[model samples]
Target: MKYLLVQEDEEGVERLWGRCAGVEGLFVDPVPPPRETLTLRGCSPEGPLSEILAEPGVSFRGLGDMCVEVWDEEEPVQWWTLVDAVVVAHQPHPGDPARYDVVIGAGVRNEESFFDVPATPRFELLAGTTVAAARAGRCSSVDGLFAPRADPDPVPLELIGCEATEPLLVGTQRPRRWAGAWADLLVLDRHGAVMASCSVDLAVSEARPSVLGYGLEDITLTDGGTDRPSPAARGIWTEWYQGPPAAPNGWAPYDAQGRTAWLELTTRAWRGRASGPDRTGGAYHLDGRFVTDVPGLHCAIAEALLGPGRYFGREWNAFKDCLSGGFGVAPPFTLTWHESDVARDALADVVEDPEGQLSYFEETVQLLERCGVTVVLR
Candidate 1:
C-alpha cells in the first residue's frame, strides 16, 4: 500500500521510524511546518503495520483498500481507513470545486470541535510597565504592559474608586438566554479628551479573568453615552478632587419598551508621569466605554481588550480613530453614535462579518429595550 508520511521536524520523523527494523517498500517525505511551509513525501511501508499505526504521532487511513498514514510532529496522527474509497468513489461537489463529497464529510467532522469555540479576544495594553519600559525615552511613543508573558509580575495600581453608568445594550437583539459581552478602556485627561483607549470583548463565562493595563496616571471610566456620575453625586467622586461640570445636554430618546438604554460607560483615572527626559509629569488616564448597543455586553468587550493572556500591541488603531473623530473632536463630545447592526452581529455570532451578514438591527434594538436600555442618537 502507498503511504503518505507528513511530518514537521525531520528529527521527529527519524525518532518515530528509526525503531522499525524490518519494513519493506517504506518511503519518507519531508514536509514544512504549517506556520512556515508544507513539505512531506510518500514513503513505502515495510515494518510492522500495527507498530507503525501505534507510532506516537502517526495515523492511518484507507484509500479504498489502500492504507494511507499521516505523520506529524505537532499534530496527532489522523488515520484514514478508506483512502481508496475517497480517491475513487468520492465525487466533488458542484459548488466547492476543491472539495469532494467525502473530503467535505471529513472536513465537517474535523471542524465540529471548533463550532462553538469563541475566538480569542484581541488584547491591548493601554498603559503599564510594558508601556513605561518601551517609552522610557520616546515622547510620541505610548507603551503598555500585558499578561501571560515572562515579564516580571505587574504592579497592581490602586483602584482608588470607579464610576460606572447603568448597563446598556447597544445591539438591536432581544436578550437571549446566552449572550456575549464586550467593553472599551479609555485613558483620558481631566479635560475628558481621550489620551488612549482599548476595547475588548469578554468570554461567555465570567470565570475568565479580564483586565486592562494602563500607566500610573490619574484616569476615570465613563459610559459611552457620557452619562457619567456627577462629581456632586456623592459616591461618584472623592473630596480630594472636584469633578467636571455637568453637561447641559438632554437625555437621548428611550427605547420602545420605555427603558432608557444609555450606553454603559466606566472610567478609571490615575496620576503618573509621561514618558521622556524632563519626565514632564502629567495625569495618565484610562477609560472603558461600551461602543456597541448590545446589553450585558461589557464582559465580552473587556475580554477582547485585556484577557487574551498575551500582549497584542497597538491593536486599537481603529478604536482610537473612532474616538478621535467621533468623540474627541472639539468641545469633547460625551458620546458618538454609529449604526449598531454590524456591531450587533459581530458579537452575537462571534464571527466578524465584513459585509454585515448577521445584522438584525431592529431585533437588537428590541433586545436592548428589554434590557431597560433606551436607544437614542447622539
Candidate 2:
C-alpha cells in the first residue's frame, strides 16, 4: 500500500497513465476508491484529519462534491462520495501494529490515517509546519526540526490538492490478493510527461511498528484486512530488488537472472501510471492499440534469437542482427560483441535450428494469445 503525494495540476490524466502516442485507454482498468475506509479497524476520515490539525505543522485538505472510485479489471471494486472528509493526510494507517527496528530507530514510519475523494477540492491550511527527517550520521542537514535527543523525530508530509482530476487512492496493498502496487507522486507538466516522480510504499497491512521509542502507545486496532484477493501474502515493493532495465545478456528467458525483468519493463511501458495486482500480462496500450498478453512474451522472442547459430555461417550472423534489440546481446565488458565463458546465454532455445526456432516462436506467441495475451508490436 504505497502512497503518492501529488500536487494536482491538470485535467483528465491522459498522459502519465495513457498509452504510447495514439493508444487510447490504460492497460490496467483504474479501480475506483471506496466512499469509506476499507481497513477492518478503519475509522472515519474525520478523526485522522482532526488529529492532524492538533499536531503542529501537519495539514490536510477536504472537498464539497467529489467522488472517489477504485477499480479491479476495469470494474468498480470500491466507491466513495462525500461532503466533509479528509482528502489526504500523513496519518499512519489503522490496524497497523507497532514494533521495533534496530535499523530505523522508531516512530518515523508508523501512524494511522484516512481520506475522501472529490473534484476541485479545496482545503484551507489548518496549520503550518515544514517537515524534515534527521540527517543521520555525517549528514548534518536535518537536526532541530527533526526530533528531540531522547527520541529523534522525522517530519511528516503535508498533502496538497490538485484542482483537476479526481483526487483519491486508486488501489492499495492487499498482500493476500495483489502482487504489488506502485504509488507515484508525479510532477506533470501540462503534457503529463513525468518531469519528476516519487514512488511510495504503503505496504499497509498489520506489519508491526518500530520499537525504539517506548510508550509510543499502541494505537492501531487489530484486524486482518477484509475481502483480500487471496489467502496467501504477496511480496512488498521495498524488500524486492530489481536490476536495471534492458537485460545485460539476451540469451536466457525466464531463467537465470532475467526471469523477473519483465515486471519492471511492463510497468515502464503501461499507459501512464498503472498500480494494481496484475503486474504481469494484463491489458496494455501499445502501438496505438490495446494488447492482452504481458511484455514477457516479447522478451521471450528476442531472447530466442540470441542462441548459437545453427549453421555456423554468415547467414546466421545476419539473421541474429535482424531481431529486435539486436538478439539481446550480453555486454561482456569488452569492446567486442563476444560473451565470456560464464554468462548464461539467452539464445540457447533457438541455437539448433533457425527455421525450427521460428516455428517454436510462433507456437509460443499463439499459445499466449489463447491465454489472453495478444502481443502488440510497436
Candidate 3:
C-alpha cells in the first residue's frame, strides 16, 4: 500500500517536506493514525514490531536500542528521521527590537498558511528553530527584517545622496589695492563652490583680529579665535562670479599688519591669451611687496603671466634669460635673498614699515625683476 510519511515535532505541529505533492487537507498527528496501527497489527501476527511497521505517519528518531517508533507505516516511507532543534521565519514581529523570532514546526512551503495562527508561541518556536538552523548553515528569508520607522536625527548629507561638487572657476584678474595694501581679487562663478574651496593657514604669531569681505555687502570678522571666516567668503565668491563678464569690483579683504610682513594669497585664476601678432603675450602685472618678499613669489608671478595653466612655459624661458651666462652655456645660478625691508627682522627687528624705512625693499623688487617677476610699485 502507498504510504504517506508525516514527521511531527514534540509540539505536534506538521513540518515541511521537500519536493512532495501539493495535496490539500492532508492530516498530521503527533502519533501514528489508527488505520496505520491496525495495518501494522495485521501484518505482524506474532510481534508488535511488525505490527507497528504497518502503521502510517509513524517514525523513530534515535539510535538502536533507544529508538522508539511511534508507529510503523511501511518503515516511515524512508528509514532515517531527523528533527531540527530550531526553526526560523522571515516575518518580523511588530515593534520588536529583535529582527526575527524562532518558530517550532514542520517547515512549510508557504508561510502564508500560518498568518491566522497566534504569533506569541509561533515566534518563540521560530527563534529556537533559527538557532538550530544556524548550526547547519541554513538561514531564513531576509524579507520583513525591519519595520518602517524614521531614522535617527542628524543623518550625514552624503549618506542621503547629497554629494559634494568640485570647485568652480569664477573670474580672474590682476591684483588690486585696498586701503594702502594690495589685494588679489577674483569673482567666484558659484558662491557655494567657493565657500568650500578657500582655506587660510593662520600661523600662531600671525593670529590677530581680521575681517574678510564678501562682495560689497557682507563682512565677517575673526577675533583671533578658533573659528575662521574663509568658508563664508568663499560662498559669496561663488555666488557673484558666474560667467565671462565678471563683476568689475569683486570682493576684497585687507591685512591689519600691512607693512610688517607681506601676505601671499594663492588662488586659481582665469586663462586668456593676448590678441596681437607680437605673440609675446605672456605677461602678468603685480603691485607692491608681494613680488619682493619671496623667491617663490617670482615663480608664481611668472606662472600667472603665461595664461593660467602654462606655468612652466615661455615665462620660464624668460626667467632663464635673466641668469648670467658666458654667451653659450653657464651653470644655473642659485637665486638667494639677503635681508630685505620685509625680512629685516632676523631677531625682533619689527619695523612694521618696510616701504619707508628700508632701501633693500626696492633692491628686492629689482632682483625679482631680474628673475622675470615684474613688480609695479604704486
lDDT of 1 at 346: 39
> Taking the candidates one at a time, how many backbone clashes does each contain?
95, 37, 32
Listed in order, each prediction's TM-score against the native is 0.17, 0.20, 0.21
Off-target runs (Cα >4 Å) in candidate 3 are 1-236, 239-266, 269-364, 372-378
lDDT of 1 by residue, 1-378 (tens): 011111124364311100111112111111111111111111111223223323454332321222222223232133222111211123334555442222201110010121221232111111111101010010111111111223222111111112212221111122232242434333343444332232322111111111322211111112121222222232222211233213211111222111111111222221121222221112211122332322223222222322311111221222233223222121121222234334444344221111223333333334333433334422
Error of 3 at 300 (Å): 13
lDDT of 3 by residue, 1-378 (tens): 011112245797633211111111111112211111100111111122223223453244111110111112222111111232112212233445233222322212211121222221111111111101101111222222122333222211000111111110000011121111111111123321211111211111111111222221111111112112233333333332343223221122222222111111112222222233222323344322333222333333333333222222122223345233321222222223322233322212111111233333344445455644444443
- What TM-score quantifies how close candidate 2 is to the native fold? 0.20
lDDT by residue (tens digit), candidate 2, 1-378: 121233323573432321111100111111222233211112222222344434665433432222222223333233233323343333443344231110111112111224322222221111111110110111111111122224222112222221112212221213334232233444333344442234433222221222323312111112212211111111211112132223422222333223233333322323234333322323332121111122222333333322211110122223233321222232121111122111112222221121133322344334435444445433
lDDT of each: 0.22, 0.25, 0.23
Best by lDDT: 2
Comparing candidate 2 with candidate 3, which one achieves the higher TM-score? 3
Q: Rank the candidates by TM-score, best first.
A: 3, 2, 1
